[model samples]
Target: METKKYPIIVEQFHFDMVDPKTDTNQNVQVAMRQVEPSDPARKDELKSGNMFEIMVPFDVIPPQAGFRVSGKITRVVQTLDYFGQANEISPDDLEKLSRPLIEYIETLTYQVTAVALDKGYQLEFEASGNQKDNQ
Candidate 1:
């Protein structure tokens, strides 16, 4: 299958080199983004199931950093008013009635952590809460 590239800025990064040479512990900075599927075929996949996936660079922790990222975006029914009522919409049911316009997943808040890089490679990384953006 033909694939195109998209941008993915690492929102959170945490690395501890027990053995940076071979350990992947210091390399996985997977970030999740919520987006609407661009292709019709791709949209079908997400509609089939409310489940989604996380795309990763094929090389994974390459000599150079920053790679393209993409993933499936499934509908997530979130309550606008938590204390108002309990009438929540199930993801399955939402896809069933995909009408004139499809309801996309609405994301409010995100906790992104970013690590400083030294020429395409991670220099120093620290873990923090979802409160503020990491640098």
Candidate 2:
């Protein structure tokens, strides 16, 4: 595998269980967006080919399965040779850039479910689609 052009740093992570009773299974929904950095220094750094940030919010609903998970994760990505605009990043590149945060989501969910349900659930995401499967 080729090394990624961007380096990712997670700035924030928050996870919570909306429904603790995991009874029924529901699909996971993951969404991502690029937002202007609220910090002035970071905004300036973007212009200088330094970094940009993205917000990834996810929801896992296993209705009646004793648990529903929801959270938002923020990551700051360091750029190399690219700094024109956040939207300018291609969809594929953005997906690749956000891979680590997605894994974070998977790991956290597994850990939480293991302790709460007495069994661990594994979440896997494919590159081409939003489909997720729990094992």
Candidate 3:
């Protein structure tokens, strides 16, 4: 089988799903999100909740890192300055756009900034982190 490996994969789960006879002791898996090397990192401004913005490569079943969130860009927000120059969304707006999907996205980025939103709300990416361990 040709299996591909990723730096991280995140899965959502439901602890409330109980099958009367099939299963009751397990939390049902609900949703899953995956990120390839194209994934972005957590922003420096948002790194206060992280350890030096080094998001790890791992998976979360229930998405625990979402108590507040790590950092990942789901939406790109653009703003304008007084000079008509383009500007990044204020921290307030960044948080506003990121808060809801933090669980799903941060899980993919692993709170690292290798891939993240930039000053223009565009995705800032580092080189692809995919590596071939089998080789």
What is each predicted model's overall lDDT from 0 to 1? 0.26, 0.61, 0.26
| Poorest 10 consecutive residues by lDDT, candidate 3 | 23-32
The parts of candidate 3 lying over 4 Å away from their true place are 1-58, 63-73, 82-90, 103-135
**Deviating ranges (above 4 Å) for candidate 1:** 1-33, 48-122, 129-135
Query: Residue 77 CA error for candidate 1 (Å)?
Result: 18
* Candidate that scores best on TM-score: 2
Candidate 3 per-residue lDDT, tens place, 22-63, comes to 321211121222222223563432222211111222222222
Q: lDDT for model 1, on a 0 to 1 scale? A: 0.26
- Residue 120 Cα positional deviation in candidate 2, in Å, after optimal superposition: 0.6
Q: Estimate each model's TM-score.
A: 0.20, 0.66, 0.20
Candidate 1 lDDT, 62-102, residue by residue in tens: 22233221222222222222212212334343323221111
Q: List the lowest-lDDT window of 10 residues for candidate 2.
A: 1-10
Candidate with the greatest lDDT versus the true structure: 2
Q: Which residue ranges in model 2 land beyond 4 Å of their true spot?
A: 1-50
Better by lDDT, candidate 2 or 1: 2
Report how far off residue 75 is in candidate 1 (Å): 18
Rank list by TM-score: 2, 1, 3
On residues 5-82, what C-alpha lDDT tens digit does candidate 2 reach at each position? 344444444444556465544443334444455777756655545455666666666544556666676666666656
